[model samples]
Target: MGLRWAVREPQLGDVRSLVEAELACFEDPWPPPFFISEILAEGRFNRVLVEPAGALVAYLFCAWQFLDLHVLKVAALPVRRRQGLGRTLMELAERHARESGGESLTLEVRPGNLAAIALYEGLGYDRVGRRPRYYANGDDAVIMTKRISG
Candidate 1:
C-alpha cells in the first residue's frame, strides 16, 4: 500500500525530521536554528507533510514582508519528489498569503533549476528580475513573482 501524507503546520517536535528532510533535499540546507526561528516568527508560515507514522517528508517556509509573501524555501525528500507535494505546499502558502493581505508571492531560485522554474511558471509566477552570482557556487538567481488576487 502507498503511504498516506498529511500537510499541516509544523510543531516543535518536528524539527529534527524537518532538518533531516531538508538535508536530503537541498545541496545547501538551512541550519536547524533557521527552521526553529522561522516557525517561531510571527509573520511566517511553515508547513510540513508527514507520513502516517509521523515522518516528515517535505516542508515549506515562507514569510510576509510588506505586501509580499517571500518563499524562503520549499523542498521534498528525494524519495518523495514529483508527487505534487511541492505544489501542494505552494498552494497552502498562497492561501495563507492571501488571507494575510499579501499582494504577491515572490521567490528566488537558481537559474539552472529548470524543473523548479517550470513548476513556478506553471503556477503563474513570472520572471521579474535576476541576482547575479547569488549562490555560493556563483550561480545566478532568477527572481519570480506571482500576483495574488483577492
Candidate 2:
C-alpha cells in the first residue's frame, strides 16, 4: 500500500468516532442512531477517510435516490480542518456516486458556513435554491447542486 489514505464504506466501529468528529464540526451534531440508520443499516450510502493507522479522518453520508445523491453531511476531525480532507471526501463520494449511476450531487449547507460554501463552490457546486430557517439556530440553508454528467 502506498502512503495515501484509505477512503471507503464506513463500518460499525466508525459510528462513535464519526459522531465525535461531527460534533466537533457542527453545533448540532446528529444523533448516533442517525448514523447507524443511514450508514450501517443500508438505507444510505456512507464513506469514510481513514488514516493508515486506522484512524477515521473524515466521512461523507449521502442519501442515494434514483440518479441523485443527496449529501446529508461531510465532516473531518476538527484538528484536520483546512487540509483538503473535506474535498477529498467530496471527491470520493462523487466518484462513488458516478460509479453507482448517480448523475448529480446535492447538499444543504448553512449560509453561515462560509468555509463549506467555499469548498462546494470551488468543486463546481452552485447555489440552486435556499431554505428559510433551515438550521437549528434559524439560519438559512443554501442548497447547492452539481451535475456530474450530461
Candidate 3:
C-alpha cells in the first residue's frame, strides 16, 4: 500500500473517465446523466481514488438512504485490481459515513461475484438478503450490511 494518495468527490469534468471506469467494470454501465445527477445530489457522491497524475485508480459511488450508506457502484481498473485500492476507498467511505450520521453501510453484489462477496465479508459485512432478477442479466443480488459502531 502506498503511504499517500487522494480520495475526492468526482466532479462534472470527471464524468467521461468515470463512465469509462463504469464501462470497464460493468456490462450494464450507467450513462453520463446518471453520473451528473449523483454528482449534484446532496449527500450522495461518486468518490475516486486517483494517482499523482490524476488518473482514476478506483472509485466508489454511494447513495445516502436514511441512516444507511448504500454503495451504488465500486471498481478498480482491471490492472489496478487487488492492490488494496478498493479497500482503502471503502475504509474512507466508512469513516465518512459514520461521521455523517450513517448507522450502517449497505451494498448489493452479484451472487456470482465471489471476489466482491469475499471482500465485503472480510470487511465485516454479512449477507442480509437477496434481490432476485436484480441485474439486467437476471442475476440475483446478494444484499450485505454492516452496522457501524465505534
TM-score ranking, high to low: 3, 1, 2
> Candidate 1's C-alpha lDDT?
0.88
Taking all chains together, each candidate's TM-score versus the true structure is 0.93, 0.91, 0.94
Question: In model 1, where is the ten-residue run with the lowest total lDDT?
Answer: 1-10
What's the candidate order when arranged by decreasing lDDT? 1, 3, 2
lDDT of 2 at 50: 86
Q: For model 1, state the Cα shift of residue 84 in Å.
A: 1.0
Q: Regarding lDDT, does 1 or 2 come out ahead?
A: 1
CA-lDDT, candidates in order:
0.88, 0.86, 0.87
- What local lDDT does model 2 show for residue 34? 85
Which tens-of-lDDT digit does each residue in 1-150 have in candidate 1? 135788789887888888888778778888989888888889888889888988888889988888899999988888888988888889888988888888999999998898889889989999999999988888899999999974
Collision count for each candidate, in order: 0, 0, 0
If candidate 1 were superposed on the true structure by all CA atoms, what would the RMSD be? 2.2
RMSD of 2: 1.8
Of the two candidates 2 and 3, the one with more favorable lDDT, higher being better, is: 3
Task: Give the number of the best model, judged by TM-score.
Answer: 3
Candidate 2 residue-wise lDDT, 76-101, digit = tens: 88887888888988887788888987
